[model samples]
Target: MMPWLARSIYRAQEAALKRPTFAYWQALERSQWLDRAAVEALQARKLNALLGVALAHSPWHAARIRAAGLHEAVRAGELPLADLARLPTMTKRDARDNVDQLVWRGVPGGAFRYNTGGSSGEPLIFHFGRARQASDAAGRMRARNWWGVAPGEREAYLWGAPVELNKTDRIKTLRDRLVNQLVLNAFAMSAPHMDDYLAALQAWQPKCLYGYASSVALLAAHAEARGIKPRLTALRVVCTTGEPLYPHQRELIGRVFGVPVANEFGSRDIGFTAHEAPGGQMLLLSESHIVEVLDEAGQPVAPGEAGEAVITGLSSAAQPFIRYRTGDVLRLAPDAATGGQGLHVIAEVSGRQTDFVLAADGRVMHALAVIYVLRATPGVAQFKCVQHAVDRMEVQIVTDAQWNAAAGAAVVAGLRARLGEGVAIELKLLDTIPPEASGKHRYVVSHVPLPAGLMVTA
Candidate 1:
């Protein structure tokens, strides 16, 4: 499809859905050039507006606002950005338990229910308004443009979202065609599937390739081992998300694709937060988010210190996540190191690392392949996968009231389908799932190492 026609179709679709994506993108492009003081002023204004909505509609946030004595300040639109720390940080459990108290169902453009990706071992269902949707879409657009890939350009996604991968309807196919996009199922990346994906990518010649960092790196390794040099001359950038892009992974991906690799930092709950620039600097979307690095005691970290990223989503008016503590750890760059923009710079990010599971047939697969199976099962509150051996797998699960014998059957059947019927799956029901020794929740851990000649990096 021609780029012009693709852009036209994309614009029409956004209009039909009443999404303000283009408008938000335009605003973001302009705001990126603002000075630091001006950017903070913008954040203060949006923060105050979002807090006012929470105060009026969200009982959970209202209590905190009043207790912090910021009710009057919020109402007056004078809430200082610094005073945001006065309110206690919110946890995933808080949002899950107080959905009714935290959501404004009557928010403009309506509140839509969605689920987190469960990469952190805690799947959460939350509501977000159209503004949050627009912010995410627009932020991605601006970031892609930074790498010379304009909106609606030819792009291919190496993703495994069940909602999208499960769609076999003609409408989904037509949408992909009209938008000049291709979706390859990363969840089913057997040796043959990876070969097919490489061929499809070469034929399609997309301007950008995007997917989980680990999956992308694995595909690169597979291609290299097979001595298949991909011919993607149109490819300008390989955008990696959903997990941390390790240094070695970055080097392998860039070398294999013959392009620069851009790492995106964000999550399902917070929307699109930041993206790496051409110079390798990660710039936050300052207009839509205010990020603070906090120590273990919830106090702000000093300049140039690594800490937890507690974010305030300005566009989350429907379900305001004022001081939401994201489990991922990061370090902020120096305040003066803005990289010619007002957006905050992130020096380093350490996020969840998923293992590569080896199948009985000797095919290497991304850990998400199995994760999708457990996440789809009913009554699964929390889960952890430990691959004890090639044919033996242990699955620790915490179940809710919805779990039953049928759900247990589903888990075993799903695992068998992916790992081959000969593989043994040990299912253990647990009261709780513990974190790794480093205190990070990794949903998937494999004891089986990668095949020889394939590199696994830290």
Candidate 2:
């Protein structure tokens, strides 16, 4: 069947089902128009209802609240955020260890099960119900609206996840076509495969583009080096997720794609949480999740201070994430004239805390720092860095269509320049870099311990 025909049929079926796409858009508009006070009040009410459900249904929360000496009548507005410290912060391990105990027994039917990417080194399986899933989808729609791509507009998704060309996937692909979306394979980012990607985008003529920041930036770099400027006139916005958007990357993508670039910060477990507004302000999606920044001692950090990000899901009922600890570091923006109702805009966010490469000289560097140099080199596709020993490092590369010794040389030179002399660097050619067991790619991996007293910055 023709791709267009398949998409049309799928869309018809979706419309028949009365999918929540339109309702979600209306809800997003309402939330965006809300004043700070109104948003907070809605959040407070939702928080109180969630707490009530948690106390009644979740064994884990019931025990924790009892241990903290909190009663069932704790109103959300009156409940101090600081008082949450009394209950232990939940982690992936805790969920994995107590999945059933964490779920709300009153939730009708079965729960929606999912696995974490183990980006921080431990994969966890979790469960949440239908309501949480719907809320998550609504939050994503709100972020897309920030880029001016509404429901039924053409958009391209360059995201991760296995592409099973089975019946279920076919049905989903058809449905997405009706909603005007094309999904490009994020796993196939090798130089040899990029031409196919560019061709797909040209054919699709999407109104907006969305994908991982690093992947899109790499493709943009490839386009620039090759002088292949495919006219993407339909493209109005380029949005990136899954990784932090560095200043250089953001600029390069905007220049190459000829569109304004927006950054979205989120996780699959919690859904879309924050989006960079059109005015260049990082706005927290306060309606979806309750966000808090805390120092090393688990105390609330002052506004504009850098600290650990903790999130509590207002929508998730199957697996209640009350004050869940996210491993990423972030800095909060100071209150400005833009209605600061104790909500801090994100100034900067460093990606996963564990993606640091340990150097032999006792220095730890962000994996992205090394990626900067590698991306500058021409004719390189996907690459991964592994530290074998204190003084030795190995780089795995998948080259462009015209693969040669030059590509390998570029990869070696890039690493040597960044890591300095006396460090042995080896480049190995690979058909493909395998994802971790949890199905997410890691740019860097280190076996050595980080130097003493070195801490990750937000």
Candidate 3:
């Protein structure tokens, strides 16, 4: 199928199912021209409606709303933003435990089920409807416009495999081409493979390149070592998400791709949260999400003060995630909403970061690939993958009642499938898998150094 025709059909199908998506996109584009007050007021209206849905449909949210005494507000149809703060923050554990009660299967656009990638070391299946999908897609479309790239323009994705996806590569490639997008597997980013990816992107002439922050940086390092200078005529920007975009990574990616590198902040559970603007500010997609930065005591932090990222999905009626604790640390930019389009600004997002895993066959993959091996295993309460060499791995698993010999076999089989049968896997059951001295939980840690070609010269 021709890229243009395929994308047109895709847009049509999407518009049919998510009727309000393009309207929301157009509305958000107009909102950028409005003041911050207007944008947030719109958000407030949506938040109240979402709360109403929770009270009426979601058993878990209903219980929470009643316990918080907000049912009266729901009855009166006047749940203010302040009233929402009264409810307890929902944790990942809570989401996992209450999936049945929290999800409204009969959501207007219907509910689609999916699971998180477990990058947080905890995985859970959740349901999202067209509204959630529309918010993410529309929000991303707006952000791309900042760099002068429109939807349906050619783009490339350096992304990980979907958790437990059973697709054949041929079908995946065909889908990518139809959408005018190219995908370089982040799950298998070996040095040689990255060289090939660079060549493909240069030939594809994609207007934008979207990828994990570290994966792109690592590729840039490889390109410099191989002395392969690429000059893609149409490349406009490189948008990096999934993890924090370090300062050095931004510089390296920009230098290699010959375009500005933008940082994106969000997670699987919370949909799209924010994107970096052309003006060097990380702007929250406030139309879709109501983000609150809170201190350890759960009090709202002052602007510019770092706090945990507590988010509310205003459009998520299928599954209400009100005041959800995202675990990521961030702060509002003191100057957020001042001049640059009322989109709220994030000073920084202190989020997940992990090391790359080296496979026995000399292939290097994102840590999440190996982490998935443990994450999907039933016995794992928590797990950490430590690589001492290309072939040897130590999986430290905090086992629960679900732990069994079959769980052990499943873990080994999953790892071997990805890393190759030559790779040696050792399972170590633990009472507790503690964080590092820095108080950070690293799911995948590699002591092995990257080969000279893949190393970044700081």
Candidate 4:
């Protein structure tokens, strides 16, 4: 498809879906250049708008706003950014349990249901509106522009979603072509499949390659091992997300792809929060988010100090996640802006670590391969996958009332299907799954290490 035709189709799809993506993108393109004070002022306006929506629709947030004595201020649009601290921060549990009170089903453009990828151990089913969707899409467009990639340009996605992967119908394929996207499954990266992926990329010659950091890095490693050099001449950049991009992984990916590797920081819950610049600074989407770095006691951390990232999504009006505690630890850059841009800077982000699962056939797969299986199973409250050996896998699951013997069998069957028929599956039901000694929750831990030559350095 021609780029012009693809751009038209992309715009048509967004309009049909009632997502104000291009309009938001246009705003983002300009707002990114605003002065610091002006950008913060813009954030204040958006923040108050979000608060007004929460007060009018979300009972949970309304109560908190009232309790914090900001109801009048919200209505009057007088709430300052500093006053946001008065309201309590919400946890993942709170968002999960109080979804009904938090979501506005009748929100403009309608609300949609989504489930987290379960990187947090416990999968959260949440609702978001088209505005939130638009925010994420538009934010990415602005970020990609920083690397000279435009919307509707040929881009390849090494992403995985059961729904997307299962829909192999002609219409879905056509839609992908119309939007200039080629989605290769990150969940299925067997040696043979990776060879096909390399061939596909060489043929497609996408302007950008985007996907999970580990998956992309693994592909690069596979290419190096096989001495296969992909000829993607049009490829401008490799964008990595869904995990912290380690320095060595970045170096490996950049060298293998012959392009600069950009790391994107965000989560399924918070939408697109930040992106890396060519100069290597991670710039927050200040127009769409209010980010606060807080210490263990919930007090604001000094600049340059690491702390948990608590966020307020200004576009999340359908399901207001005001001051939502994202367990990821990050440090703010000492400077407020980089390269004269007003977007807040992040010095470091460290969390969401997923291990690689080695299959019995020696095919290296991303941990999400098994994670998708467990996450889709009903009655699973919390779960973890530990690969003890090539043929030994242990699953610890905390179940709800929906759990049954059949679900247990299905879990075992799913594990065997991915890990191999010869692998021993141990399903252990527990009331609670404990975190690591460092208090971090790792949903997938592989005791079986990768082969000596294939190990990805930290």
TM-score winner among the candidates? 4
What does the lDDT come to for candidate 2? 0.68
Q: Per-residue lDDT for 1-458 in model 3, tens only?
A: 45467658668868777646677788889888767787777877888788889988999999988998889877776777766789999988888888999999999879998776455476666889898888888899899988998878899999887534566866777767877878888988777788789889988999999988888899888888888888898989999998888888889989888899998888878998999888788888888888889999999988789999999998888988899998899988868554468778888889998888887767778887887677677767778889988888998888777889999999998988888888889999888878899898888899888888787546
Task: Please list the C-alpha lDDT of all candidates, in the order they appear.
Answer: 0.87, 0.68, 0.84, 0.89
In the range 114-222, model 2's lDDT, one tens digit per residue, is 7554344334567877666656566666667667766466789876433236788888777676667788765444444567778889998887898877677767776
For model 1, residues 107-137, the per-residue Cα lDDT tens digits are: 9889998776455676677899989999999
lDDT at residue 227 of model 1 (Cα atoms): 94
Which residue ranges in model 1 land beyond 4 Å of their true spot? 117-120, 161-170, 335-339, 361-363, 421-423
Estimated TM-score for each candidate: 0.94, 0.72, 0.94, 0.95
Q: Write the per-residue lDDT of candidate 4 for residues 1-458, one digit (tens) a residue.
A: 88888989999999999999999999999998998889999999999999999999999999999999999999999999889999999999898789999999989999998877545688788888999999999999999999999998999999864523354755777799789999887766777888999999999999999999999999998898889878789999999998989999999998889999999999888899999988889999999898899999999998799999999999999899899999989998868565678889989999699998988887777788888788778888899989999999999999988899999988888878877888999999998888999878899999987765567787
- What are the clashing pairs of model 1? none
Clashing pairs in 3: none
| Candidate 4 global lDDT | 0.89
Decreasing TM-score order of the candidates: 4, 3, 1, 2
> Residue pairs in steric clash, candidate 4?
none
Cα misplacement distance, residue 104 of candidate 3 (Å): 1.0
